[model samples]
Target: MLRFAGFELDQRRIELRAPGGEPIRLRPKSFDMLRLFAANAGRVVSKQELMEAIWPNIHVGEDSLFQCIREIRTALGDEGRQLIKVVSGRGYLFDAEVSGDPASFAASAGLSSASEQEGLAQQAGGHAAATVAGPAKKRQFSFGLRSRVAAVIAVLCAVIGFAVAAPMFAPGVVAPENTPTITVMPFVDGGSDPQATSMATNVTDRLADGLAKIDTIRVVTPRSDVTTASLANAPTRPADTDFVVSGELQRSANSWTLEARMTNAATGEVKWTTSVAVDTENTDLALQQSRLAAGVGHELAVRINAVLYPRAGVASPLTGSTKVVVEQALASINQTTRERFTAAQTMLESALANAPDNLDLQVTLSALQTRGIQMNWYSAAESTAAESAARSRLERALQAKPNYLPGLEAYCRFLTATNNFVESLVACAKVLSLDPWNGSALYQLGLTQIQLGRFDDALANFKQADRFDTPAVSRWTWLLGIGWANLLLGHSEEAVPWLQKSIAITPASGRPYMVLAVALQGSGRTDEAKAALAKAMVLRPGSTALNVAPPKRNASPVFLEAGQRFIRTLVELGLPAG
Candidate 1:
């Protein structure tokens, strides 16, 4: 018997009873649903999961499941939707305070008793029926005559039951797992120019995004903690944050240099540090900033992973025959020119050919493919080929070492692109389970949740993504995600600032303009909306402004009210908003 919320369920009897001795009658299916939820309390159960659990072999309609849920909720005195929240279109979640002594429940359920076990199994109904079907059922009676068969079966079952029951008396087992955390400080701007400061912030943001892809580290966001002044003075770490990353920028004639350090917050010990210098005179400031950001982000991710996992051959893996090749590849990646990328690709390929099964080589190849895609150095067909190659390589890497974080993240991205959202979400969840501070995984997962119509989950993920401050590209993407999520959540006003920040960073891009237009239109700023839309058209001709499908409509009254408001704004703006 398990007790919770003033009710107790007897698994053997398959009955629910109140503290005062009244029986709460439930349909056979409703009772099963309640039992599962009670067993796995404090966890979010998706609708797909519930369907699979309760109606495993049947093609049951969602309405049937929902009816059972309604009946169960009514019996529990949960009148409103608040008790068991319907998380948008994804599934229902039960939220209630629960307390039970596991040992007491185990004893009361007679977990060690063969009779109790048999009764519980029989009470499970369909499961018992399924188990007793076909060849297994025949095997029980074929060897004996009718008179002896039942007695023989009884004796054999008794032996088997004792064998199963013996293990229940053993001590329970639980293992301790380390949870790694990291903090990303604001990027240091060596120059006094406002543009430079903004560039630095963007760089830090991107780095944080990249690092968050790793599954063994938690990244802290600078947006809510570190600031411009704090970067210079190295302020104390926040109580909840784990690691702090601080860096310095210095100008040297025509070149700019950046020195960064990652420190453990608890001990104030430097975990890793590196200095990078780039020529800024000939390169545009923005491009230079992006290059620096990518380089810093990649290196920081490597260092953090090493510290957290400490795998063999992770540090200085190419000390023997592949040393020169590895160095060449790394040097090429550090360069900003197209020629350098080609050289890096060649060197990485050679290294992989030499060690075809190497995990590091595979990861480097995937990273190169990502870079090529981002830079547009590869044509559309070429980019597709490159991504396919990367996916194949990452899959091989995972087969070699299943826990490889970089490989897992790369594969997850590929899966997402292929519209395998369920698997991708699971992979990203595993990444989070291993390392909670991974910003890239969080952002990607957030986007996937939004696609799945899990708005609240998407919002939560975006909020978490905002914690890391590394790399300018990641910063831009994170801000863009936040802006879009807010718009979807009907917070048009909150989205404006985020979209504006993105536009400020990438003025030539069409994305921010499109989002800004939506926000403007939503806010009833008709003239501004037209202007913003016009700019977006100019930026990307034949863009899909209103062509995308809207999110799944909810049954909430608030959504209906918002829809009315949206229509009013559309009328004011002189457009067919629907």
Candidate 2:
């Protein structure tokens, strides 16, 4: 027996008991997890380590592990979250003092029953008993017949299962034959200034390096400087070229600008183009080259990724009319209003129904639903359905396109919301490594940082997202993040404008307004605070001092304390006590 926190894990009896000696039921997996925790009590258990221990050969999703976590927490009645503590960006820890080598205690409790003792003695004397018995050839023949029949049945079942599931698993087994090929011609320096020439060369180098990291596409970066007009006007393109990427850099007043485009080489038609500017005045010279290159490069990469992996590489970006419907869904991701969310969901569902295998629509809907789950728009049953559908779609999408930024972003957000921060952190970093200016990924990263109590890092991440401001639909999310971080950091006055900007762009989210109320209250505008709170209450009905509070799980003590104070302020301003 091992004892801690008024509970005893009786290994001999294979059960857990509360202080009152009542048995606590647990699923087999949950019991395994609890036993693992008991063995390593008071130690931080990394998620990867835990998964490997619990599931040796199986490649299960984090959801399985998260379910077990929920089970353990419920069984322990760890509402305060003191027992199973989450170490943000790390893993989980079962923090408690446990007794060691309590075999005598199990004996005292009579957990080692007489039947169990007899079974052990029988096992020890089994070989001797077998010698005294006959060979029993009749029994052997009967067992062999059954074994052969079972083997035949198992073989048939395996073949049928493989045939049925091959498509689902094909992405990993088979290499893609239709992988898109892209060529990056060296960017032309549009200005005569030496600074502009240097900027062009740096961006040209970095852009190629960045594109090379994408596994889904084949990138060819030519060394020789090629004029943008040459690639645009030339009749011939490389024989294998599917797309040609060419751009020009110029130094304008106080900023460096990059005008970049991707062209369909075979059709001699322009595919995509964008203009990006990096402020020389605001950014130090050291980081300017990266900003200029990634600004335009990130956009082009997303466009290329969308064309190749129409399964929503970055926020479920689609290519055609389906894209328009998907964009409606993306809107809910940006604004987060309950009505808009439902409407967008209905639209996507209808569109997806028309084309059930549309992987792009699947992931887009998944991403949208993840946002709904984050906003608590789903009931218990609804949340389960939403999470299940989204998880299936995301897993399938990822299996198909591992480098798709949109899918990665969605999965990253899913893991973050599930309190699986360690994997979420890695996912966010992967998105950034693929496209450094990915605003969606940055927003998710900032969220993780906030939960970790790294308020300053979170603020910087949000601010960086604002600066890059790529994929403009996701603009409001980062804006809200910045304000949220500022409020957490106690710079309430500074948080006001950012929060207001976020609300202006996407006024549907009651969360932003509720947070805005905090900023206003902290700024000592009592009347304005009450007004903001009223609007928030109107936006989100049935909110209370209790339910309105953000979850404390995995959030650092500093963040929890700050959140408590913010909740107290909201209550003071008129939030209900329920």
Candidate 3:
């Protein structure tokens, strides 16, 4: 008898039963499959091993094995195959605790010993095998002997009952490894209309589809056969799912509103939430639905990825001190003052002194030092020295953790600033491959595109960054990129709104105003253009057409001509001639 999480399997009788003594019938092959999984609980069993064990003498395709797995899950009442998880690109993992009465049952049943099992493995196409087969011999028993065996079985079952039942009353625990698992529940319709319900379902489907694109994430598919009783008595943790996404969709006369939130399944703690509104009056019905679903889906993907992966190629299980140091360093950068920058550098240096091997700290310190040099916080020679040291430390960190998101992002930025456009593009693309929802990587990719004079491609990437905006309006660079891209393409009217939004979010910078001035000048708003130029001059002293270098990313004369025209426009808008 093997007992695991409210279920029992009797090897002698070849039967499985639920906690209520109700027999849970499984097909012959499914029973063998369950036995193998139970015997190796909490360990991932390879597909090849499973196939060999279940179909020892015959050749079979993978579909047969998949069907057996599906049947086993069905019999066990395992929602989302939580007990028999499919490890993507690997095999299946049986994530459960196993314990049982293991004395005379094996000997009485004449089950194969280790040596016999090894022989059976050799028979199974030379693959490493699993033991899911029942005993080959059946012994006839006297009535009195049967009565004695039944008594012994009852006692063993009672003891195993307590063993499995104790965990049901215990605190919920969720154990996730490298990949984060999420479950997206159907969005509930907040409005009375039945059509709203269909729309809500569409949103949920699209959201799941979008999240599935991320390689490091596992999206749980809820069973359609789940009953009302099953949901009412659902496990607190929903098996192995780490996060549950649920929300409401409401529709008004001509607009729809969708709100969603992610909650930690075990703790039931809300991790993140967002609400978006869309107007559908002017758009076609199908197009509106798609746009709404895609928008929310993209937003959710970014938010989830930001929390799970956080940084490119980095799996997040950060230690307390490392998280604190990283947060402080980032906050210091956002302050954008010389004093805060120095303080951040000092804090990182002190932390690194204690734990020089900490890659997170090393990467962050390198980025901060590089940013200080770019901002002209140090003299020319000092800046050069700092850049060299930062680059060396970054190279070391990358050597240790090549896919570390923060390091890759910083390296891309550094490469872009140093005019290594092609290399920057490659590094940023690598980051995106690891985390498609990474807005920072997308922004960097857009900048690389701008440098390469791929204005249309740059626009698309910038818009994607906006769609996946993790911190809402946190990234002003992509907004400015969009505006500048439009201006370069002679769409100054379209550039104004984006440039204004960038300025609103980041007024301390002079770049947006400089571009805004040119945008206004091109639109023949001379007075407004001069006013904008004045603001830019105050923000960035000594601005002049002569000193302002043109972008070096031009592939042909057209881009060069456009750059000259913009510089001429800037000069006409009251910038110094030099």
Candidate 4:
């Protein structure tokens, strides 16, 4: 029996039980999945690996896998989604600690072995009380015979129990290989300033600390001066590490840039390189340092994880026009305009026609479609078709390459766009679990929290995202989320600045303007509210107060009511009611 979180998994009985011993019902597939997770606790189990194991040679879709995951989570009361965590693109990780009872009752009680049973029989001949199965009148058997019978019965029971419980030894489970060790070399200071040298040292330590947070990679500090060039030339790493990270911190006129690269220790190949800068002018000194460390650390972590858990890829990578088309398509997604969205969609569709199996193209198109869904760019039927296509494509891509980060991000966005807030909670959390500094995933998490009416939690998430400010392209999203959440909590005055900040970053998105109007109206600024409403109307024409509010389907009652209030306020500001 395996035990975790006060629950028992009975291998012999093929059952799961609560702490009080009530049997928890699980579908056969779910039971198998749970058993697999229990056996490989703390390890990521890929989706393909799982389907192959659970269904064997039978073909299946990802829905079946998700259903099993859902059922397992429900059975384990894993509402927090911590027990069985989705590791973003890597796979599913059973994060819970597990233990098992390997010593059977016979061994613990000292009565199972043949010699022990013989000794028991001999002892029973003199003093052991024994019983025999017989009629009461014929029950007066010799103690030696009764004891011998008892010993035989005990031996038989032990053998039967051992045979029945043998499966708990976990036949298919195997230990994972050791984690890849990463050594963080000291940072080079580019400027002559004494402060720059101190900052570089601090950044080095901070980067190491951040990388250490990732459980998949082991971070080691270099004892002596180390450089990527030196490590590359050496036959062996000083600590026998797998990878080395070397970086230089430079103080610029307006910003501090940290350039870093990771090289394979044995091959001397530079696996990844990045340069990230933090604004020293606008941000506080400490905040700049924090962002500098997080900026580079987040990127390095992604690259390292990609190398460690590479997804299934095509024989040839996207190059030339295909690569440009893909990049352009993704850039257009950031524009947040209806025409740009449609054009980008067309571009991706055409490119995908040539390489239908390209995972990058598939995920990009799905993400663009998901963005359209979020922006209400589709009619009801088109929206349905888009959602279905996005989900199917993403599922297929993820099943093919379960640990791909882009696919995971797109999936989380799809879930949030469809208002699958409950599942979005899990998906977004998984993204953040692997990439803790991801602002986009954090925005999704906060939005889901808002719909669930957890206003304070939503605000906290948005603020946390703001603190990280990663992928600064997604900054406007969390800013808008913060403003919307504050408005939802009736802090209209406090919501105004964040909404304005969002508009300053991406003024084309009418939604932020709509939110600004709401905040202005709530603050009793009628003229300002009308002005904001007019700007929203210009950016998002033909939006009726009735349909301008978010889709009410599947939303919590409190959120739906608040949404209606937002719509009514828009109506008051001359928004069309049709």
TM-score of each: 0.42, 0.60, 0.57, 0.66
Instruction: Give per-model CA RMSD.
Output: 19.1, 21.0, 19.6, 19.6
TM-score of 4: 0.66
Output the better candidate (2/4) by TM-score: 4
Q: Residue 271 error for model 4, in Å?
A: 3.2
lDDT by residue (tens digit), candidate 3, 22-119: 99888898887888777666655555456556665344433356557756776787745578875542356888877874334333333354345434
Instruction: Flag the better candidate by lDDT, 1 or 3.
Output: 3
What RMSD does model 3 have? 19.6
Clashing pairs in 3: 312-405
- The parts of candidate 3 lying over 4 Å away from their true place are 1-183, 218-220, 223-244, 250-325, 332-343, 369-383, 473-475, 550-561
| lDDT of candidates 1 onward, in order | 0.56, 0.68, 0.63, 0.71
Query: Which tens-of-lDDT digit does each residue in 1-578 have in candidate 1?
Result: 66777888777787888878699999988987876666545555544445545665344433356558767866786643345654321235667665654344434322323344333333332221222221111101111112223334433433343233223211211111454656667766767977667566555644554454343444555544445344334355456566778787676678767888877676677778888776777676645554565456656765665565454645335456566765666444423346677888987887788777667777777766665654456766897899778867766665544555666666655544444454555455444433344566777777665665555556666664554333334566667778877887888888888888867766554546766777877777768887876776566554441422222232234444543454454344443443
Instruction: Rank candidates by TM-score, best first.
Output: 4, 2, 3, 1
Cα distance off (Å), candidate 1, residue 483: 1.1
Model 2, 267-339: lDDT tens per residue? 6588899988778886765367666666776787678756765543344345678979987787667666788
Q: In candidate 4, how many Å is residue 34 off? A: 38
Off by over 4 Å in 2: 1-186, 189-244, 250-257, 263-271, 277-292, 307-324
lDDT of 4 by residue, 1-578 (tens): 88998999887788999999999999988987787777767766555456545775454434356658767876887744578765522356788778884234224323234344334433422111111111111111110111344434433433343243223212211111566778788888976898898688667755665565454556666544455667766654565688989888888789999888888888888889999988887677656766787788778868876786554355335677878988998887866699999999999999888988888899999999998887888998999999999988887776665546787788888878887664565455446545667789878877876776667767877876776678788888999998999999999999999999999999886878989998999999999999999999999999997567787666879888898899899998989999
